[model samples]
Structure formats: C-alpha cells, structure tokens
Target chain A: MLSESDLGALAITLKLALLTTLILLLLGTPLAWWMARSRWRFKFLLEAVVALPLVLPPTVLGFYLLVALGPHGPVGGLMESLGGRSLAFTFTGLVIGSVFYSMPFVVQPLQNAFTAVGRRPLEVAATLRASPLDRFFTVAIPLARPGFFTAAVLGFAHTVGEFGVVLMIGGNIPGETQVVSIAIYDHVEGLEYVHAHWLSGGLLLMSFLMLIAVYALNRRFSVVQP
Target chain B: MTIEARFRIDRDDFSLDVDLSVPSRGITALFGPSGCGKTTLLRAIAGLEYHHDGFLKVGDRTWQDSDCFVPPYRRPLGYVFQEASLFAHLTVRRNLEYGIKRVPAAERKVSLQQAIELLGIGHLLERRPARLSGGERQRVAIARSLAVSPRLLLMDEPLAALDVNRKQEILPYIESLHNDLDIPVIYVSHSPDEVARLADHLVLLEAGRVTASGAISDMLTRLDLPLAHGSDAEALIEATVAGHDEAYHLTHLDFTGGRFTVVRKELPVGSAVRLRVAARDVSLTLEWQSGTSILNIFPAIVDEVIADGEARMTVRLMVGGVPMLARITRKSASVLGLKAGKLVYAQAKSVALLS
Candidate 1:
C-alpha cells in the first residue's frame, strides 16, 4: 500500500502536468502558427531555439530557470521590487520549468501539421470571401486537428514524466511540489522497495496507455484532405 | 460596361505584360497554349496576384490601381482554381454556404437554392468532399462560387483536371451558367474546342502577350491567328432555329450565309444557337452543284487561301458577310483555280450544333 505522502505526491504531479499542458497549448499555438507561415529569412534561428529543449539536458534548463527565478536574479529582482517573493521552489516556478521543458513536444507537431496544410485551401477560402482570420479558424484549425491531439497528449505525458527540471526548481515539498518521480526516488532511498515498485509501475502503465490512446485516435480520425 | 486591365509582372524566367479591355457581359475566354500567362492574367483580375504596376477597373469599380489595391477577399469576385479546392472537413452544403455567409445581406444576390439547382448538386449536400468524384467535386466548387453572387467570376481552367468523360459531363453545367446568370465570367482555357463552345469574346495570348482579342466569331476564322490554321480549325456561326421537319428528323437553321439542315433538336424556333463547321469538312466549287447529297451549301467568295502543308490548303471564305473556312487539297485548289476574291460555292459536309 502507498503511504499518505505518496498519494499527495501523485495528486500534485497530475495537477502540475494538467496545468503545464494547458499553458503550453495556449502559448505555443500562435508561436507555432507564426513559425509555420512566416517567410522571414532568419526563421531558422527561432526554429533552432524552439528545438533546443528537445536535445537539451533538463538539468541545464532547470539551472538557468532556477537562477532567473531566484532572488537577486533579474526576474526575482523584479518580483522583489514589486512586493513579491522569489519564485524559485514554488508551484509557479515548477510550472515555468515544465513549460520550457515540454514546449518542443507541443510546437513541433503543430508546426509540421500547419506546414502540411498547403496554401491552396486558404487561397480558396479567400476567393470565397473568407478573411484571413476567418480562414484560420474555419479551415486551418479543423484540418490540423490530429496535430492538436498529438500535441496535447505528448505535452501532457512529457510534463507528467519529468524529473530533473522539477528536482532543480521544485523543493519536493509535500502537497505542493513533490511529484511521482520524486516520491519514487525518496522511497528507493529509504529502502522502501515495495512503494518504489508501485509508483514506478503505475507511471509506466499510465504513459503507455496515453500513447496508445493517442495513436489509435489519430489513426481513426483522418485529416480528410490530401 | 467594360472591364479594363493592365498588368506587368516580372519573374525570373517569364514575364507577363498586357493592356486589355473586354465587355463586362457574357463569357470572355483567355485562350492560349500552356505557360502563356493566361492564368496569371486571371489571377491579376481577381486580385490574387498582386502586381505593383497593375490597373484593373471592372464596370465602375477600381479593384487595383497605382494608389489603391483591394485584397481578393474584399473584391466582389469569385475565383475557381484548376483543382476543386473544397474544404475537406466541411460537408458540400457547408462548402456552398461558406461564401454566401461572407457576403453581407444586401450584397447576396444569388440564393443558395438557385446555385445548388443550377449545378445539379442537391444530392451531394450531406456528403463530404472526399466522398465525391472529381466531376461532382468540381460541380460543388462551381456552385459554391456562384452562391457568393460575385460581380465577376474568374475560372482558371476549371475542367483541366478532369478526364474526357468527366469534362463532357460537366460542360453542360458550365454552359447552363452563362445562359441563366447575368454575371460576367473570365474563363482561362487551353482547349480551342472549349473556347469555341463557351466564349462569346476571345482573347488569344501567346508568349505572355495578346496576339489577338475580339469576338469569338472573328477570332476563330481570322487567318492571322493560329486558330485558323490548325487541324482543329472551325468557324463559329450564330444561327437561329427556323423550323423542324418531322418527316426526315431534321432541323432548319438560318444564319447570315443561308439555311442549314441538321438533326432535329429540342430547341424551339427563333431560339439562338451556335454552329461549328470544321474547315476540313468544307469543300469549294466554282459554281453551285445540283443533285448533290450535301444539303447545306452556300455561295461564298474566297477571301484568302493559305498553304496548310505541302499537300493541302486552307481557304478563308466570306459567306454573305459571315466568315467560313475550307480545307482542300493543293492539287484540287490549283485544278479549280481557287484564289483571293473569287466566287465559289462552299459545301459543308456536316455542321455540329453547339449550345
């Protein structure tokens, strides 16, 4: 049986993942759309920056974010001057770390999907008197639905399974920042093999189910256009 | 009213430069071979291809000029692409309604029901585009554009993507649009047959320039143009139904030259129709021949005779002020002593009833 602290950590982990996935979707959509459509010569620079997280070590990202959110750092200094405490080791700091860590997971799929949606549909829509914004909502978004599903699933799963970034930013406080990975780590450290086995197995099974669900659903829903 | 346009487009390998003025009624076909910039001209008229040195005035509205440019969505025009670019996620009904919803209430002139009926696509309303064949998809595309009630319609080789049978199936729908609607259509086509059957005005483009622009009747028969010399060369005759003889299952048609005997049709008397007489089907004689099987014969004067190849010649004839063409053997031409301004009788082997 899992301890009370294990349950708390599991709840906190799911909560963090849900919020982080939601935030990534909201912020990454416009950025991905611009990346897909813009004809700027230096677009590759932004593309490389967004893809950095995919190849980057989570600890490196966590280390920079920790400093940025720590007191005397730029962001933390600004917060301090504005009558707020430093953000490091807080839930908000954890969310920020998770967003940066899982951003490419959400943005890359969307960018590919948007690019795959060639300009013909949009041009046809325009000739039919649909404005630019109207075409995006009615034509583009609906056509890229499979990408949305893949993004949401990958973003949620990646954020949920994260360990290093959270360790660097979160203080592993109970009912606040402690998550499933940290809980398993603590159990193993304390020689609690049974608890570690339960948490680790549960995480593995849940992630596998998520990926299966996404792939099956994606295959079922056709993009409807060639 | 007239539509006038001047566009100058500079590209890496090709360029288009033209100044054109065409009447703002019926169908005007941009007829050319491939890569002659006919599609580019159509796009410019629709405001799809933005040219810095461009001028367009349709009726009284200035869509593009030196100081002003209207985007494609704002212009009162509908454009059909080479492919049926229907939204895959939407049903046929929704696709048809997409343009209708964009136009303001006061500007919606063609109702959705009318467009649906015109294209004969009511059975396809609930189906998605993926479920339709190429011909049905094109029909939906045409209907969708018509439902917008555009002041002008631009079609860039709409049937170019379909097969021969599919084109035949869709041609009647396109033909019905001109007869039933008052909107002016600028159609781009590479097929001379399509231009002959559909367009009232013809704009011949070559190497990104206008070689000739005039009525289809004159353009098809003008020996100076390529259309007059090809194996597909045919003269268009505007005739009206005079009478039908039930005894022989034939119809009598009256044109500028004389009366024609053709297979009986459902068209009523006094209704306007078009006739296509191929150059190869016509043979010229010095005087009218009697007791001949050919019933459609007219007294014509040879206007010009040009060598088609080493073996044959193409003769341009004036049949009572209307132009007609004849392709005869060079040996026969010399044997009959055919020449310019010589009186002759042109016997049409057969005349095809168009529209």
Candidate 2:
C-alpha cells in the first residue's frame, strides 16, 4: 500500500515528465533540423554543446542550473526584478532542471532522423514548386516520424527517472517538486524498505514498457515504409 | 520566342560557363558525356543552382538577372530528376495534385486528367510510389510535373536510372509528350540514341564548355563534330505515314527526302513519325540499281566528301534538300567517282522507325 505522499510524488513526477517532454520537443525540433542540415563550418561546436548533458555529470549540470536559478543568480535575479519569486526549489525549477537533464535524449534522436531524411526529398519538393517551409512540413516531418517517437519516449522516461538534477535544484517538497525518484530515495534513506520496493518496482516496470513501445513502434515504422 | 540563358558556375573540381539561346517550343537536348556539366546546366536553368551568376529569360518572364532571382517554386516550370523521386508517403494521385494545388485555378493550363491520360497512369493513382515499377514510377513522375501546367520542362537524364527494357517501356510515353503538349523541354542526356530520336535542337557540352549547339540535323552532320565521325553516326528524318502495303507487309513513310518502305507498322495514314538511317547502312551507287533487294532508293546529289581515314570516307548527300550521310570505303568512293556535285543513288539497306 502507498501513502498519500507517495501518490503525490508519483503525480508530480508524471506531470514534470510530461511538461518537460513537451518543451523539449517544441524547442529541439528546429535546433535538431538546423544541426542536421546547416553547412556552417563550425556547426560541430553547437553539436558539442547540445551533447554536453550526455557526457557531463548530472550533478555538475544541476549545480550550475541551481546557481543560475538561485535568488542572487542571473535568472533568479531577473525574475525577482520582474516581480516574480526565485525559481529554485519550485515545480517550475524542477521542470527546467529536467529539461536540461533530458536534453540529449530528445535532441540526438531527432537530429539523426532529420539527417536520414536527406536533401533529395527537400530538393524534389522545391522543384515541384513547394517553398522551404511547405517542404519541411509536408516532406520532412512525415519522413522523420520514428525519430519523433523515440525522442518523446526517451525524454519522458529520462525525466521521470532523473535524480541528481532534480535533487540539486528542486529539494523534496510534497505535491510540488517531490518526484518519484526523490520519494524512493527518501524511503530508502529512512529505512522504509517496503515503501521503496513498491515505488521502485513500479518505476522499473513503467520505464521498461516505455522503452519497449519505442523500439517496437520504431521497428514497425522502418519495416512498413522504409 | 526563345530561351536565352547565360550562366557561370565555379567549383573546386569543375566549372561550367556557357551562353545559349534556344527555340522555346521544341525538345532541345543538352547532350554530353558523363561529368560534362550537362546536369549542372539543367539545374542552373531550373534555378536549383543558387550560387550561379547569370541571366535566364524564358520568353517575356525573367527567372534570373543580376538584380533579381526567382526561386524554383515561384517559377512556372516543371522538373523531372534522374530518378523518379515521387513522394514516397503520398499516393500517386496526391503526388500529382501536390503541385497543382500550389497554382491558382485560373492559371492552370493542364488538367490532372490530361496528365494522367498522357502518361497512361490512371490505374496507379491510388497506389504509393513504393508499389510502382521503375517505368511506372517515371511515368507518374512525368505526369506529376505536367499537372502544374508549366511553360518550361527540364529533365535530367530521366531514363538514366532505368534498365534498357524499362527505358524502352517509358520512351513512348515521353515521345507522346512532344506531340500532345506545347511545353518547351530542355532534355539532358548522354545517349546518342535518345537524342537522335527525341531532339529537334542539340547542345553539345564537353568538359564544362559548349562544344556545339544548333539544329540536331546540322550538328549530327557537321564534319568538325565528333558525332559525324563516330561509328554510330546516323541521320534523322521526320516523316509521315504515306500508306501501308498490306500485300507485302510493309509501311510506306514519306519524308522530305523520299519515301521509305519498312516492316509493317500499325499506324494510321498521315501520322507523323521519325526515322533513323545509319550511315553505315547506306551505300552509294552511280545510278539506280534495278532488282536490288534494298527498298529505299532515292536520287541524291553529293554535297561534300571527306576522308574518314586512309581506308574509308564519309559522303554527305542531299536528297530533296534533306541531308543524309553514307559511309563507304575509299576504294568504293574512288571506283564510283563520288565527289561534290556528283549525282548518285543512295540505297538505304535499313531504316529504323524511331516513333
């Protein structure tokens, strides 16, 4: 059986993951597309930056983000001056943290997908009298379908299971920043073995199902169309 | 009216620079060897080569100039790539409609039905490109381009990706476009057979330069050009179906030169067609030889004679103002006394009907 706090933590974790995944998709699409297609000589520099979250320690990223959202830091200072509270230790802070923590999981797959679409289809559309924007929507998006699926699933799952970034920036708070991973950590630290088992087991099953869905759906897409 | 274009493109490994003015109504073949910048020139005319510097004037509309540039989508033109790059996700019908929907209704000149009927692709409209064969896909691709009713059509080796049988399967549909549509075509090809069959005007390119450009007949017969000296050198003749000899199973084709009897063909009387007479298949005689097996014998005047090598020479003959080439051994030429202004009989042993 779960406590009320456990359910609240689960709900918060789901909500955070959903919001973070949505934001990543909206922001990462064009970024990934540019990374895939642009011919700039220094494009690899931007690629390296986007991939930083993958190689860097999560606590290092979270430490920097925490300072940036703290009361005296640039973002938090700007927020205070704009008549808003500091973003540290809040639900919004957790959302921001998870977005950065899961950035590579969403962007890398989308970039690879966009690259796979290639220049031929876009050039074909152009010759057929389609403008650049029209070609991107009509040709590129539909062709990169599998990439979107992988990005969304990986983003959501990675955010749901995040521990270091969430802990550093979003201290555990019931109904706010108290996500599933943090709740399970609290249970283990307090010697609540049974409670930890239930949340940990549920998370393990959910993550496995999400990954399975991505692989199975992506394979089907490749087989049916490609 | 004519299409006047001047383009200069520079690349690390190659460069293209040329200025041309071609008739706006006939099939003008940009003929060249592989890596001869033929496709690059076609792309420049289509506005796909963005970094090129030049001017493109298609009739009254200027697609590109020093001060202005019209992107490909804004230009009223159709382009068919080497491969039939139909949108894999869309059904054939949707692919055909993709460009038509972009053009306004009043501006539409070619209806979707006309394109479908022209390419004979009515049955494959509901199927996706993946379900089509190579020839079928290319036909659908051509139809998709024609659906937009473009004033100019550019094709870059449209049959290069297909096998020989597939090329034969798609050639008739392409030939029909010349008869049924008024759009001027800039066809890029390396195959001499395709150019001889389809082109009225020829632009020869070599090493990113325009080697020759003129009427196909003139270009193919010019002694200075490589085409005249090649072993496959031939003459193109535009003819009409004069009559059919059912008793002998032969078809009579009447051209400006004269009538040619070939194996029977199922064609209506007065239908226009093209004929290819290879130079090697033609033999010159001092007089009309009676009782010869050859059926096409016409009185020809020797316009020019040039020694091909020590053993052979090519004789250019004029029959009723139409030019023909006859390749004969130097011994035969000497024995027959063939020279300029000499009256002779050109006996054509084989005439292949092109269309």
Candidate 3:
C-alpha cells in the first residue's frame, strides 16, 4: 500500500497536469494556427523557437525558468511589485515550469493537424459566407479535432511524468509542490522498493493505456475521412 | 442589368488582362484553354483572388474598385469550386444550411427547400459528404451555393472533376437552375460541348485577353476565332418544339433557319430548347438532294470560306438570320466554286437537342 504522502502527491500531480493542459490549449491554439497559416519569409525563425524546448534537456529548460522566476528576475520581480511574492518555490512556479517543458508536446501536434486541414476547406467556408472567426470555430477547429485530442493527452501525460523541471522549481514541498514523479524518486532513494514499484508500475500502465486509446480512436476517425 | 469587370494581374509566369461587360442573365461562359486564365478571372469576380489593379461591378453594386474591395464572404454571390468542396464534418443538410444561416432572413431570395429541390438533393439530407457519390456531392454543392440566395453565381469548372457518367447526370440539374432561377451565372469551362449547349453569351479568352465576346450563336461561327476551326466547333440554335409525329416517332423543332425533325423527345410542345449542330455533321451542296437520308435541309448563302486543317476547308453559311459552319474538303470547295455569296443547301446529319 502507498503512504498518505504518496496519495497526496498523486492528487497534486493530477491537479497540476489538468491546469497545465488547459492553459496550453488556450495559448497553443492560436499560436499553432499562426504557425500553420503564416506565409512570412522569416516565419521559420519562430518555428525554430517553438521547437527549441523539444530538443533541449529538461534541466536546461528548468534552469532558465528558475532564474527568470526568481525574486530578482523579470517575472518574479513584476509579481513582487504587484504586492505578491516571487513564485520560485510555489505550486504556481511548478505550473509555469511544466508549461514550458510540455509546450512542444501540446503545440506541435496542433500545428500538424491545422496544416493538414489545408486552405481548401477554409476557402469553401469563406465562399459559404462564414467570417474569419466563424470559420475558425466551425471549420478549422472541428477539422483539427484529432490534433487537439493528441495534444491534450500528450500535454497532460508529459506534465504528470515530468521530474527535472519540477525538482528544479518546486523544491519537493510534500503536500503542495511535490508530485508523483518526485515521490517515486524519494521512495527509490530510501530503498523502499515496494512504494517505487507501485507508483512506477501505475504510471507505466496509465501512459500505455492512454496511448492505446488514442491510436484506437484515431484509426476509427481516419476510416471515416474521405 | 449587366456585369462590368476589368482586371489586370501580373505574376512571374502568367498575366491576365481583361475588360468585359456581359448581360446579367443566363449563362455567360468564359471559354479558353486550361492555362488561359479563365479560372483566375472567375476567382477574381468571387473575390477569392484579389487583383490590385482591378474594377468590378455586378448589377449596380461595385464589388471592387480603386478604394474598396469586398471580401468573398461579404459579397452577394455564390461560388462552386471545380471539386465539390463540401465540408466533410457536416451532413448534407447542414452543409446546405451553412451559407443560408449566415444570410439575413429578409435578404434570402432562394429558400433552402427550393435549392434542395432544384438540385434534386432532397433525399441526401442526413448523409455526410464522404458518403456521397461524385454526382451527388456536386448536386449538394450546387444546392449549398443556391441556399445563400446570391445575386450572381460563379462556377469554376464545376464538372471538370466528374467522370463522364457523373457529368451527364449533373448537367441537367444545372440547366434546371438556369431555367428555374433568375440569378445570372458565370460558368468557367474549357469543354466546347458544355459551352455550346449551355452558354447564351460567350467570352473567348486567349492568352489572358478577351479575343471576342458576343452572343453564343455569333461566337461559335466567327471564322477567325479558334473556336470555329477546332474539331469540336459547333453552332448553337434556339428552337421551340413545334409538334410531335407519333407515326414516325419524331419531334419537329422550329428554329430561325428551318424546321428540324429528330428522334422523339419528352419535352412538351412549344417549349424553348437549345440545339447543337456540329460542323463535321453538316455537308454543303449546290443543290438540295431529294434522295438524301438527312432530316434537316436549309437553303443558305456562303458567308465566308477559309482553309481548315490539312485538306479540309470551313465554310460559314447564313440560314435565315442564323450562322452555321460546314467542314467540307477544299477539293469540293473548288469544284463547286464555293465562295462568299454562293448559294448552297446545308444537309444536317444530326441535330442534338441540348435542353
């Protein structure tokens, strides 16, 4: 059986993953849409920036996020100036770190999906008298549903399984910032192999099941497509 | 009412410069070769493709000018792309409702029900676009466009993607649209047969220019135009069903030139129809032969004669007030001394009722 602290960690992990995925979808949709539609000659430069987090080590991303969110740093200093404390070791700080760490997982799938929708359907909507915003909601979003499904799953799962960025910023505060991945690490370091096995085995099974669900559902969707 | 359009587009490899005015009724075809900018011209009218130096006026509304440009969705028009670009996510009924819902209630002239009936797509309402055959999809596409109640309709090679059978299946519905609806239509196509059958007015496009524009009958018989010299050169005639003879199982069609008897058609008597007379199906003779098996013979005057491909010569003939073409051998032209002002009898081997 898992300890009380381990259960608390699992609860915090789910909370953090859910909040992160919601924010990512909110921010990534328009960004991914722009990446899919922009024809600017220098657009590749922005594409490279979005792809940077995918190639960089998690520790490398965590370090910069830590500094930028420290007391004297830009984002934290602004928060302090607004009558708030720096977010360096808070749960909000973990969320911010998980956001950057999981950005590529959320944005890239959405971008690919939007690109696959092509200009033809949008043009058809325009001819049908739909305005730009209406087309975005009705034609573009509905057509890119598979991309959103994959992005949401990946963003949520990757944030849940993350360790380095959470450790760098969250500082393993047991009831607040401490999550499942870090709790498993603590069990392993203490030679409590039973706790480690329980947490690790659960995460492995959950992730595999989520991926299987995605593959199975996406296959059905593709078969319906012309 | 009339549509006046002028557009000048200059791209790296292609440029289209056209200035034209066409009456705002019936089908006005933009006829040309594949790369001759016909589709670009139609897209320009739809505002899907914008030309910086352009001017367009449909009826009394200025769609584009030096200062203002109406975006596609804002324009009072409907456009059908070459492929049936229906939304795969929607059922046929929803696809038809998409544009009509965006339109204001008072401004909607074509009801959703009318469009469904006109295109014969009423039976396909609940099915997704993916489940439709090519002909069914195109009919749905047409109905969707009409549901918007546009003042003008633009179709860009709408049948170019269909198989021969599908095209045959869908073309009559298009004719019904022209007959049942009063909205002006601009049809873009390279197929001479479609133009000869459907177009009341023709705008001949060549290398991004309007070489000529006139009534369909005149355009088809103008000897200098490339349309008159091709293997598919055809003369269009407006006729009314005069009567039907049950004894011979034939129908009599009376046109400006003379009466033509063809195999019986189901069309009611006195119904106006269009007919296609292929140049190759017409033979010119100095005298009418009483022993011939041909059913249509008209006394005509040779309006002009020009050398066609290889050993063939094309002769322009005026029957009553209508002009027709006959492709005869140059040897026969010389032997019969066929020239401008020479009288001849035209024997039509076939007269195809287009509508």
Model 3 chain B worst lDDT window (10 residues): B191-200
| DockQ (model 2, Cα) | 0.67
Q: Model 2, residue B157: what's the lDDT?
A: 95
Q: Compute the lDDT for candidate 3.
A: 0.92
Isolated chain A TM-score, each model: 0.97, 0.98, 0.98
User: Best candidate per lDDT, number?
Assistant: 3
Candidate 2 lDDT, B87-197, residue by residue in tens: 877899999999999988998999999999999999999998888899999999999899999999999999999999999988998888899999999999999989998
Q: In model 1, which regions exceed 4 Å deviation?
A: none
Most accurate candidate by DockQ: 3
- If candidate 3 were superposed on the true structure by all CA atoms, what would the RMSD be? 1.4
- TM per model? 0.97, 0.98, 0.97
Candidate 2 error regions (>4 Å):
none
Chain B, model 2, TM-score against the native? 0.98
Interface RMSD of 2: 1.5
Give residue B298's lDDT in candidate 2 (0 to 100).
97
**Colliding residue pairs in candidate 2:** none
Worst 10 residues of 1 chain B by lDDT: B42-51
Tens-place lDDT per residue, model 1, B110-217, is 999999999999999999899999999999999999999999999999999999999999999888888899999999999888898899999989989998899998
